[model samples]
Target: MKNTEVLEERITAQGCTEHLSAVEDAIYVIGGKWKLKIIIVLQENGNIRFNELQRNIPGISARVLSNELKDLELNGFVKRVVHAEQTPVVVEYISTDYSRTLQPVIMALSNWGKTHKRNIREDAF
Candidate 1:
């Protein structure tokens, strides 16, 4: 029996619904086209300013990044720090402790993506 065989096993309606609900909730939180991308960037870069973030994530507009950062901050996954003590105010965004909890999920998805691409390439040959 292979991993795919186990995946094909029939599940009960209640069990299916429960599993779907969990996935749906996950999608709701990290579902946006840019949420996970933003999280991954912040996690890797540590603390970065708005302009830097915009530059790091190609094709993302300032307006969209602003919205996503606001949402991440609101959700407590990212922290925004504003430094007004200097001549020019500075603002930086960093992932929160809670955000670290997502590392395993991101790594798992990354591994799956790599495997899926390899499988597709193999099937094409």
Candidate 2:
């Protein structure tokens, strides 16, 4: 092979490795079934209580929701606010500005999901 071709191949391989590493990091932070869903709900609702969040995403148990919230908070995608002045302490979860960066990704996934469902239905018939 030509020297130029070898150099191009090396660059391509390195690019692919970098891309894969970035994707892996993103997945590690937000790969779970409930994490994105939780973010979506929080973004839509602004600030919501724990019970409200659980209700918004059906099928998520309190334990799982709690765990996911903690993960999101740690990742800086979510803000947990506590209101102490109330007779009983009230806590709410809100999406951080940083989480807005995922809006495009979420939209892309939503569009792809719709298309996939339509294709599946057509194939079924």
Q: TM-score, each model?
A: 0.88, 0.89
Worst 10-residue lDDT window for candidate 2 reads: 1-10
- Please, what is the whole-model Cα lDDT of each candidate in the order they appear? 0.90, 0.93
RMSD of each: 2.5, 6.3
- Residue-by-residue lDDT tens digits, candidate 1, 1-36: 137535567789999999999999888888788889
- Tell me the deviation in Å of residue 84 in model 1: 1.4
Spell out the clash pairs found in candidate 1.
none
The TM-score that candidate 2 achieves is 0.89
Name the best candidate (by lDDT): 2
Residue pairs with clashing backbones, model 2: none
Alpha-carbon runs more than 4 Å astray in model 1: 1-11
Distance from true position, residue 36, model 2, in Å? Answer: 0.5
Candidate 2 overall lDDT versus native: 0.93
